[model samples]
Target: MFRKWESPEAVFHLLKACSKGMPCDITGIDDYRMIDEKRGIQWPLPDGHPIEPLSERRLFEDGQFYTPDQRARFVFEAPRPLPEPTTSAYPLTLLTGRGTSSQWHTQTRTGKSYVLRKLHPNVPYVEVSPKDAAELGIRANEWVIVRSQRGQVKARVFVSHVVQPGQVFMPMHDAATNQLTFAAFDPYSRQPSYKACAVRIEPAPVGRSNHSALPALNLFIASLGE
Candidate 1:
């Protein structure tokens, strides 16, 4: 079944003639040919479109919407509390976001290039405010264990004023980063609340003279497999 529709042409044909019907206005092979001719084409470019020689275009120029009233509607709701709140054990809020513009999500594809890797930090590290680091006795570039209710992961501390005293920032590129995030989600969108979680940081235990952070990380991952 998989081999039957492997090629791009076959997939395109199937999309054009699906029983459920195509969501967009992709009619036939000519539409694809038009896409190749023009670098890219916007969606809803049905066959015999009014705008000839389709180039770049925008939708709803006249402020019209796909509604019975032809006007957009806005909805508002009261804010809800975070699923995991900070406690005495886990006092700091862990905020996760993109590390660098050069690195994509998870680093599955963008991590391949040596040049790209050089542009960003090679290893996972958490951003800690100077005030917070000073209180915790954590120095810059020192190994630290970030712990949440879900799990814990070792990361290097980067002392910066960018984060607030009660908040720490970690990039989502690291695999272990998500291990500390709670499975709570928004009720409406159903998107997991990856931004905020309760966490605490402590200095990592000293290792042998020959052991390094990389080897420690490998051991941590191996332990998870068990």
Candidate 2:
């Protein structure tokens, strides 16, 4: 059971076998030994290739290319228009991205650290341009609901000049933020194109709670103070 690929060491051994003849071959690594030694191994260490961790190694030092003609190749394509553009209904471009160094994708592991938790705000907040906030009657730290064709998310108003009048920024750390993202994907790579979506903002009802989608997060933050 321990030898199964589900184990960490077994997975590395399987990876080594899969990369046997590839440029990223990792044959020099041993099971669990690298961790105990606090050492690392650079890949392409193909069974006989000699290199050490942190050492300078160049892939194409011989001035050769992998192309059929042994020369470099470059490709270009015309720029594509945004699939979800801002309209009169959803008049603002909702930009979703990391808010701070302390926050990460979904806050799965970082949210566990008390010190990391304190670095960023516990409540979800949206960065709106001063121009938009004034036009929408949104006050600083006031509860606001952002809506898109897909869904909606509640966030506090953070009026700043960082964003333009036609744009608003929301941190992707909250799972609810995904509900408002555009559900588009690249045809070639199949990678999700969710960075930008058309959404509109309005002042939430006066009695809205601070918590958006994850109430447990507020509880977790409260426990830290005790």
Candidate 3:
């Protein structure tokens, strides 16, 4: 079995040199010590530099960039079609984003907080427009199966006007949410196109429960801490 390091500082010291040439100047162990003294300073501070007062500091104020021309560059290209298009089988567009300000990605740590979990929905849910839910015979809080070309998962139905007809919204905190996302990426930036995908929603089988194990486990752990 793999052994854990004595402490995080031990690991940081081993990888300190790797930070060289990065945008941030946290290239040395001493720079990290400044965190306690300066209450955290923005990068680009070389050794022997004095800490600036804690305040917002923007970079590239002179409109200079790291490119060879020392100027910013822009790329323009013709619009490309979505990797997955809506079809008769998958007639709705699905979008995913942050569930709440208190919850972060995956909710591995944020989910542990009782206050944060209480502020947001405890279970995974998809927001569907009233028109779509009514047409599909889906009721609020009923379990629904959302399917895409890639995969599908069960989520509770939340009939809300926040989403428009022919579209649905799912929070990104659930692991199952990404099972349906397309792997297609932008050619220029190589960023995955996670915002758009074709999906279809149907009511889950009778007597099916919408509760997820992870959230329930997290709540149980939080209760133990109380």
Best by TM-score: 3
lDDT of 2 at 35: 45
- Lowest summed lDDT across 10 adjacent residues in model 1 is found at 216-225
Task: Report the lDDT tens digits of candidate 3 across residue range 10-37.
Answer: 5654455556655565553373565677
**Which structure among the candidates has the greatest lDDT?**
2
Rank candidates, TM-score, best first: 3, 2, 1
lDDT order, best first, reads 2, 3, 1
lDDT of 2 by residue, 1-226 (tens): 4457677778778877788767686776665786467465555577766655568777767666767786766657589988899999999998989877887898999988888876675677788888888899887767889999999888877777778889999889878899998878987658898799999998777663554534444444344335
TM-score on alpha carbons, each prediction: 0.76, 0.76, 0.81
lDDT of each: 0.76, 0.77, 0.77
Clashing pairs in 3: none
Identify the superior model by lDDT, candidate 1 or candidate 2: 2
Candidate 1 clashes between residue pairs 3 or more apart in a chain or in different chains? none
